[model samples]
Target: MTTFTIGDVTITKITELEATGDTELMLPDATPQAVRQVTWLHPHYATEDGLLKTSIHAFAVVTPTRRIIVDTGLGNHKMGRPVPAWNGMTGTFLQDLTDAGFPPDGIDTVLCTHLHVDHAGWDTRLVHGQWVPTFPNARHVFARTEFEHAEAAPGHGTAELFADSVTPLVQAGLVDLVPANEQVTPEIQMVPTPGHTPGHVSILIESRGERALITGDFIHHPVQLARPSWTSAGDHDPGRAATTRRVVLEELARTRTLLIGTHFPGPTAGYVIPDGDDTYRLQSLA
Candidate 1:
């Protein structure tokens, strides 16, 4: 239940899953030797054997005005998911959230950065054999453009995801489809950082001069922070995703702002500082 406070806003990392494996599998472009050479990533981001530590988690953003669950991790009992391990699986995501002090009903907002399988899975839960919204009292927010794009151009895992995790919320009439860059509250707003998906966006939290950006899927791993041009294979548009990463990373480094990457493992929340003119490093706040 580690939490970082920005002004009055408290952001907690509630993990759904944690793993350590190949960095090259995720980054592809960055081989073991290349990644190992980064030096700063060792003992935390990478193991002695060269495995990369990764976490699939959500940021429970507790603002003065609202309790927002950002990016629900891969849900349970889901089927037809593209990833073999994610298919028909179950996890303790909700119970973990409750244990962290934010119960399902207590959450006032569910902010999804995008409609990807992992980020949107827990948007709903299995209820009496039916998929339903887990947070009964929350305004489940999504960007209209992202939703529409996911619906019309569903890809691997996207169809099943829309059918189970997303559509159910829409049917429940709890969905708030706002403009891609709309602000949810005084302290919370969306940043349009597409390329991960057609309308994928990142969440920005600001309060009392302090700031942090929840990097949805814009940049998957810390290596990408150093090698901004290295895009994920899953990226909808690798080129655009790389572009977004470069711009966002530079701003984060220049401003010395806190970065909470959705899929970042080990020490998740950190600051991006300039390593050289063209690259940067992740300094974990944990």
Candidate 2:
């Protein structure tokens, strides 16, 4: 388990799945030849043969007054998923979260950066052939725009995702549809960094003059830090996504904010540093 602290706030990673290679499905342009060119990616974000290493996990953010889980990973027993490997997953994500010391009942807030399949899968669990809220005591928060968009035009495996993972929370009256830039807490706020989805937001944590940003899907891998123009295949708007990437990276580099990638593999936290006039690299904090 990897953890980082910003002042009194503690952020711990609870991993559900991790894999290397086959990244081309998400990033078509990230071929082995192209990925090998980003020298900074070697040994951590990328393999020797040039395949990108990625992870699917959630961050347990504990502030002085609240405990929150951000972006729950692919939950177990989800069916009809587009990705064969992601379907019918039987991982010990809930136990893993408990072992990390942030039990489901202890979490008072469940924040989803966006309503994507991988990000919102664990919102509910199958119980006696019925879907139920996993974090029963917590209020599940989602951006209004994202929720509406996904409801109207569900994206890859999102139909099943909504039927099982998301709808249950709404039915139980545990969902909070907030604005894109709502203040989650004094130390944690949503930073509107859309384009991966219409209402996607990156989380910002600030306390005691220290700051960190939990990147949603706006910037997937470290290679995107170097090539901000490269966008994921799942991007809702490629042009806007690329623009957001460039702008976000510039600000991150300028402010020297600790960047915590949502899907980044081990050594996931880093600092964005300028490589040249227009490019940048991630200086891993691990």
Candidate 3:
């Protein structure tokens, strides 16, 4: 139940799905030989098979003028997820949103952190056997570069992510693709944190004097905070991802700003701290 407020805005975490996925391969730099070197950081994640959990977190950004949702996690009816649990299945996502006291119709804007499957899942829903924007009256925001990547349809890693989660939004005319550094509101702005994706951007919340960053996949897990080089196997550009990770970690450490990681353990909100010369750690906040 970790929530934060900035001026008139109130942000709450709305979870859609929670399950462990192939994380063992993510360690030792996703190498075949390093399989045995993997270990779980928490007993809750029983096995080392990546020992990671996927959470579809929706950040309900309640402002005086608008109710925005930053990152809509995997929506229902998504196809072609490597993991069976992520594919064509009905979950309580929309109901959960309403349970949290904010219905889909209440949302004025839906901001995607990036166009990854998990981040863009809830962007659309099944309607009369067709996919449609889950947020009917909302303007779905996306990065122009991100949409292009989907338009190109690269290959395995991100091909389906766009075809399923993003392209449909464009078809519906509800999407608003902006420049990488576009600012949606006075209290919110986008920071160029590409690497995970070509136009990946992290949302910055500057209200009053406090600051917070809604990190999409700039760094997936807390372990990345300890070893910023642990790039995800799904990264479109590993080298660039590493560089972005280092830079973002440094900035988060310097500013002592609160960060919200999409797949972070438990509450998924924390601050970065220096572990050694180049390593850092995630210190969960109150």
Candidate 4:
């Protein structure tokens, strides 16, 4: 379900989407309305507001020595979600991972860009109604600050989501709560790109002069390449998220860094390119 290799790193996109009904998730002003314009939505997706869709993707980063997973998508057995699509259900993300040749036990590290439902879903799995780490041997890495905040606001309806997907990993001794800016490896560095979450970090990979930035929910669609200020309603801090998006896009556009959006449609892997006069577009790799 995921794409692979911008340079040397191998990426696998895992999906748990039940449908592809809503097509307009990209907006025109997004690059310039996000999800409203750049998105290739069908006629049905058009509405008074904008496009909307729900296909969750999780990325696995396979290196020479380490098998790392970035952002575990929506998992099974989660409760209290608004949508019936993502609440208390079973899916095939793990099966798809194995089909992609990465079994659950093979993952050495679980890197959560942030602790949202879609981003942190597969950290654990259901075993006779118990939440267990999907990757039994892997260390679940999360931002200490994010975990704290989510923990503090337990009854605010977000508590159960984090409790099932995150807290159990910590209690089982598989969690590695690191500082916001901790560098997991030479090829991998966690840049503290807060706003989405207080400790949200984007994973950067540089090898043989080739660099790829796994943009974990920083900007959802290609539209953000142009209008970096259009924060999604889901962003924890819209203003800060917009600011981070602008800064990240500016640098990526300037440096021509390769990128992979965790939620981008079709070929999720691509690069942010200057379209014209300060505008930008996403060029996907085949």
Q: Each candidate's TM vs. the true structure?
A: 0.97, 0.99, 0.88, 0.87
The predictions' CA RMSDs to the true structure, in order, are: 1.2, 0.8, 3.1, 3.7
**Candidate 4 clash figure, as a count:** 18
lDDT of 4 at 237: 80
TM-score, candidate 1, is 0.97
Question: What clash count goes with each model?
Answer: 0, 0, 6, 18
What C-alpha lDDT, on a 0 to 100 scale, does residue 165 get in candidate 3?
65
Clash number for candidate 2: 0
lDDT of each candidate versus the true structure: 0.86, 0.91, 0.76, 0.73
Screening candidate 2 with a backbone cut-off below 3 angstroms (N, C-alpha, C), the clashing residue pairs are: none
Give the winner by lDDT: 2
Top-down TM-score ranking: 2, 1, 3, 4
Evaluate model 1: give its lDDT: 0.86
lDDT tens per residue, model 3, 1-286: 5577766567899887665655653444543233223343343322354445545578888877888999888778888876677788788878988888889998999888776677778887878987777888999888889878766865543577666666687788888889989988988898889888888899998887778898888887766776678888778788899999998889889997888877765667777888888787667764
Query: Considering lDDT, where higher is better, how would the candidates rank from best to worst?
Result: 2, 1, 3, 4
Name the runs in model 1 displaced over 4 angstroms: 22-25
Predicted candidate 1 versus true structure: per-residue lDDT over 1-286, tens digit per residue: 7788898899999998888874454678777767777788788787765566788999999988899999988899998887777877777788888999989899989998889898988888888999989887988888999989999988978999999998888888899989999989899999899998988999998999999999999988887767788878788898999889888998988887899888887778899988887799998986
RMSD of 1: 1.2
